[model samples]
Target: MVPTSSSTTDRVETFRLGPFVVPRIWTGLWQLSSNAWGSASVSKIRRGMARHVESGYTAFDMGTINFPSFDHQLIPRTAADHYGSAEIIFGQFKRSLPSPEQIVGATKWCVFKRTIPSRAVVLAAVQERMERMGTTTVDLLQFHWQDYSDQNYLSALRTLKDLKAEGLISAIGLCNFDAIRTDEICTSLGQGVIVSNQVQFSIIDTRPLHGMADVCEKHGVKLLTYGTLAGGFLADKWLDEPEPDLYSGNLTPSQRKYLDMILKAWGNWSLFQSLLHTLRAIGDRHSGLSIANIATRWVLDHPFVGAVIVGARLGVSEHPDDNQKAFGFTLSDRDNEEIEAVLSQSNGRTIITSIGDCGAEYR
Candidate 1:
């Protein structure tokens, strides 16, 4: 279906998704769908979606980076919701399918990971997705590679390109790949491939600037940044807490370790508090925009970033108001100095080696 842009406050931006356009800032369902999923029944999951769309999030993130999503939520939820709801399924013929204009469904591929299984193996996986999602095609299918040493990466891209040509997918993307590896794929495909690079970009993790951004900019490749809030540590709740050993509620073990490193790099609890305090001061000037909304907006404001993946964990906590604040105001140069003043005391570009790459936070 032809797509139209959604209205947003001036601070927010939108990008074209084939015919569909989506907010550059979106709520990622992975945080909730990560583990507690067996308990994440359909009704409960739908409630999460209801709250998400209500909060103005119109996109999602998934791929081989986390296979649990492909089998459980991604494929199934797509199937259940792709068709029109009972209101139309009961016989309103014109409403037999979801309005293609309504939401943007996106997922990625860990193609470099060597999980393709086989040509048929990969085909069956997405076919199951089509059957389960009940849609003619996936909006975006991102590729992920585990090791660049494997020459099979290009083969995987070829398969994806073939599928897109076959009209089975709308757009293709790459996940967790560095400049070297992305160059390999792009050089192989030339102009016929990837449109976006999903990476880990935030205030703390700026490794993408090491050269990835320039490459993407040259290729017109979009970067969808994650960890903008550094897995919630940038929030006010951490302003007084002890360095957490094991964080609970939607954060994975890697997330806990990642944030702890940030706290350490910031120079112990003292420096962290300084950063939080500065964010609070800057945030106060903006009528209660939390540190998270500020940090996320900073990433959103960056050029070449088509979107930022903000984790969503409904019921336990809802940040629709704070999330909305991201699009309410802009960060000033002085405010950026206040933030950099705190960040200046810390080791920048260290998170990349620690985590390996942007999407390397997985595993």
Candidate 2:
């Protein structure tokens, strides 16, 4: 049940997830998975989580695979220190404080094995996630599948749905599933079992708008978009810059991944600069926001999109104040036309035709 009325604060937008409403902007902690991004002090990560909470971006997206280190595996440990408990932390951002239905702690289990996991194996994984996050139940448990041929993805979701029925998981969602498979899941499970599909969607990557958007709209499903900033390449920092070498020491793993997507799907650096310049101009029209803010807002305006996942560099960087500018002003039809004009001329079309669907890149 997605919200129909205006949100309590313009800084955040709300959408329904099972019995709860979640913020439209989610804090992505995938960067914590590796040290490719510069390391930050624990204090910085803790303060950053607090700032994100205070700023009303409470819906969090984390994954077990994202944090490979065993010692400090879960970053939400910082939230525990700041807000005392997961309930309190998530409750503080919701309109109704301490309400059981406000917070959404979404985590995922990536099934990489050639064989499908059984019900018992899946349950153990979900329980482990709950224990790691310091919560009785996960607000949403997103599952990622690498092989579509393995009918086990369906079995996994069914197990998750059962967990939801048993009060272990509040909702179930998918990550990186394509339109055809998403349709299959919905048909197999019947309605209302799955709430969202987390995929890569951005001004550069409009693959969701092609097929996934229609499928989601037909059903009641919504999309939680990541790589929306192309791993921070969509920011103004890369505008008019030289094409970075693939092996550049300065590039983080995330940056390298998205940069390749940019080159392959978005064409060369000059074209990207043009797109960035257009976004910056649009931002200027509305209190000089930022290329990143304008880019994020563009995705949020898409009808089937529930939220945009922006990666937070824990303690190293903070952009709450700047990110809030997305809601300060709306993109006029003219602004949209201008942005589309640039996209129409780029390699976006070729990328769409070549790339099968939202998750084709991974497959």
Best by TM-score: 2
Model 1 CA deviation exceeding 4 Å by range: 1-12, 36-41, 63-101, 111-118, 247-255, 263-267, 353-363
Instruction: Look at candidate 2 and tell me the lDDT of residue 304.
Output: 93
> What TM-score do all the candidates reach, one by one?
0.80, 0.86
Provide the lDDT at 160 for model 2.
82
> Residue 200 lDDT in model 1?
74
User: Cα lDDT of model 2 overall?
Assistant: 0.74
Candidate 2, pairs of clashing residues: 33-66
User: In model 2, what is the error at residue 54, expressed in angstroms?
Assistant: 0.7
Model 1 alpha-carbon miss at residue 339, Å: 1.7
The C-alpha RMSD in Å for every predicted model, in order, reads: 6.6, 6.7
